[model samples]
Target: MSARRQRWEIRPPAPADVRERLGLPPLLATLLYQRGLLDPAAASAFLAADYATGLHDPFHMRGMAEAAARIAAAIDRGELMAVYGDFDVDGVTAVALLTQAIGAMGGRIRPYIPHRAREGYGLNNVAIGQLAADGVRLLITVDCGISNYAEVVEANRLGIDVIVTDHHHPPAELPPALAVVNPKQPDCAYPFKGLVGVGIAFKLIQALARYGKRPANLRGRDMLDLVALGTVADMGPLLDENRVLVRAGLIALNETARPGVRALMAAAGLAPGLIDSGAIAFALAPRLNAAGRLADARRAYELLLAGDRETADGLAAELNATNRERQALTRQLQARAEELVAQSGRAEQPLIVLASPEFNAGVIGLVAARIAETYHRPVVVIEQGGETSRGSARSIPGFSIIDIFDQCADLFVRYGGHAAAAGFTIATAQIPALEQRLLTLSRQYLRDDQLAPRLMIDAVLPLTELSWELYAGIQQLEPFGQGNPQPILMAPNVTAIDPQPTSDGAHLRMRVRAGNSVFEAIGFHFGRLAEALQRYPTIDLAYQLAVDEWNGQRRMRLLVRDFRRAGGARNGG
Candidate 1:
């Protein structure tokens, strides 16, 4: 870990009366109150966000009625439809859910996922015209098409009506689709605006179930497994309706009999049980994404839609192999990008731009993300093709990459992304100008302090307060990700006991003691801190509680996030 002060923004103490009224442990109450669940009514609602009761009315979205009516008419008329999607996990699952739902509703829905390397992201006139020529009368875009102004016009000219069910931020001039269904639209009035592409697609399915023809057994709730997969994979905020969706979706996922899901879990080495957002994000999503990153994403889509275990298993193995290949490529590309930045003296710039004709376009995003995290700087990695260049950018906190790119949008062929991560395409001739403008924008938006990594500590506690009850209490805020993260607790003045590196010599396995309490703690990548452990007997440790299961037994373990010397000194990794 890079050297930096571990800033502890300790939560203010809640009123004693509120803790007593909630009948929660003081620590639990403090954590909850710090997360803005102070009042009893708000706290109750958050904890009790069940899917059945928590989902907003489908019609609450602005274009739901119109979109649903059009889809219903198509289903009634038996007009062929297509579900166009992007290449990421969110887009693939969105395509799967919408295709399955509409197909079950007696609509001829075919799935179309654009090639990441060839078609790039979002709608294209080539794919649009091809689908129209193939007799697709209606096009429903999931997770994309928010910025396909010209492509939507092409589809219209080809006599195809489009219902864009996306979650991306739309520009001022909306696509002239049949109905635009995105909560982020300025004129829209959706109660919850954090739905992923799959979440929005699920909402459309729910509306179709209510207003259109469907099989008696085609309950939209049954699709929560896919909803959970896509939502968690996309890193949507685990709050509001999203919390309800994920909470119930996890249940559905654990109990799902879908052969494709089962096979995927097996390939990922995930045991048959409950899975959290972490599992989806780290294990499942990566394997699914590998297909798109290194090969044809259609394999992943087909894996999800696979009917037999044999087919699903074969597809799962392919994805696993692709994921491994992607990992190797990422490591290789990261080294090259880092060396380029260092050798060219580009690391001193506020914005680091590394470009190479040899860089694989598919893995530039992953390389950019890794470099950005390592240096704690805004990074843009551009892959130069024969005539065009594609760039993926990752930003540190306080710097909005998409906003910065918007300031220089005229140089790009196309660009769209969120605050932190974005991708764009431009002609090779514009690379120098893009670099200059990006450096200028970064200087304007980033401060010196923002370049340093800062770990935010949620609360401070003594080891004596650690207990199974407290651990379980903190877990009430489960399904943590993005907007709501796993709480990081600080344990102060713990003496290191039996401090030693693990067998690999990359991590430290040790026992720490505070007063009369002793607990086993493992610090990942903390082997470099052996000298510091010997120098500073006492340290303040930041960690999140994790349950380690071994030999059919479960025990609480501390996964150390960061540590500092007890007396205001930097200590460990």
Candidate 2:
């Protein structure tokens, strides 16, 4: 089936005042202005998320001091503490970071991560009773427990003080825990609210460090590698405090990662000394997440904090094998989901609800994301079981999946997540009715244009802006994510001077000329554009500025993201 193509109207930014503010070249200034940073100070601050400048005082959070004090008291009294976490990469890393910190501080700590298939997500009464029975005096939750009001109450009844360090959105009724240190909490006073679950745990470590409570021997930077892995894997916004943590953490990962991370990197065929965000996102995160997806998350946590190199290597190999299995399962599930969409005769529906009794609950999120991307609509993938059917939902811009579930709260037995992604459970009988109701809700809320995907351009620049200086200047806006994104520049009326298809026939390598400048560009997975290239040499290209190193030489290249015919009525001036 041929997918519908949507044309986007691109407009170049006004370049008059931005040139004078940063004393930058016109192209760099125009790119900066297009990115919503007009002032030099703001541009500099945005680009430089140094550890010294970007980190905020952890105590600024509403309950950080109380949580820290309670943890400290627990250590001093020799009380047993349990770290409760979920069964995902973020949750596992949060548990691992806290476990390492607490152990280093000479505290008795145990980690509890529920099995995805058996125990499900968040705090449960059974787990609470188990912790109490194990003589856990204090329970500090990571990544979860923000909305477990009943579980927290049960823990309190069992004389277990609960401290929640989570990043999930808080519910209307807050859990009455000993101290809730979540940036997403409605009453939180923290400056930056984009911290991930592990990021929040790192903040607790930061708070402990302030009082000389952290281990004297352990360095703060050592744990940053974990922070980067979890922060990026969780898809937390790389802005504010998260930007700082990820920036420093990437450096730590590249230079001096822990033995476990090093071993995993080797197993994944990645060079240990040059890891970047892409490597972590595509290579490392999935392997660590695979354990939780297919098995127990505790295995991942153990791999990260393993003491012996041999064990770490063995665990890394196992994780690699599991990741391969996860990939195959996801592909099968995605294919089935697409088939269901076709059969429904509502493929263009604003929301996709797919259910399969054979679907694995752990990989449903991946399947949902794939469906959402393929159909350009929000998707919810449900895995039917005996008593309840669990589902995971992924959403597009302007549609909050969590809020949509909240609006239909009566239908769900339990649900929680942020705006873009969420998970829930319902009685198996309710699946059809719930799906129909959601489709109706999607029709009511989503407009035709909203359902179409968009490629948002920051600015249109001339070929003169595709210089080394301009590329380096744009790097000032580093560590970009939700609030800040990598700038996309448009170069118009450019003629393809040299075009050739790659050996694999999946990408096209080309050189384009505009005015007196010539630039090299590569369009990955766009070899089909070669047919159109023979008819028209001129094209408008939207791309990100990239620095490419080939054959021991460094040069600037435009990583082409999208393209269209130029110099016609469809092209905007």
lDDT of each: 0.86, 0.84
What lDDT is reached at residue 556 by model 1?
Answer: 86
Per residue, candidate 1 scores C-alpha lDDT tens digits across 420-520 of 78888999999999999988888887898787677776777778889988888888888888788898888878998877888868788888899999888
Candidate 2 regions exceeding 4 Å error are 1-4, 11-15, 462-465, 493-538, 547-551, 555-558, 568-573
Task: In candidate 2, list every pair of residues with a backbone clash.
Answer: 47-476
Tens-place lDDT per residue, model 2, 193-278, is 88989999999998987766887567889889999999988888877788889999988888764678889999988876567666
TM-score of 1: 0.94
Model 1 whole-model lDDT (C-alpha atoms): 0.86
Report residue 314 deviation for candidate 2 (angstroms): 1.8
| All candidates: TM-score | 0.94, 0.91
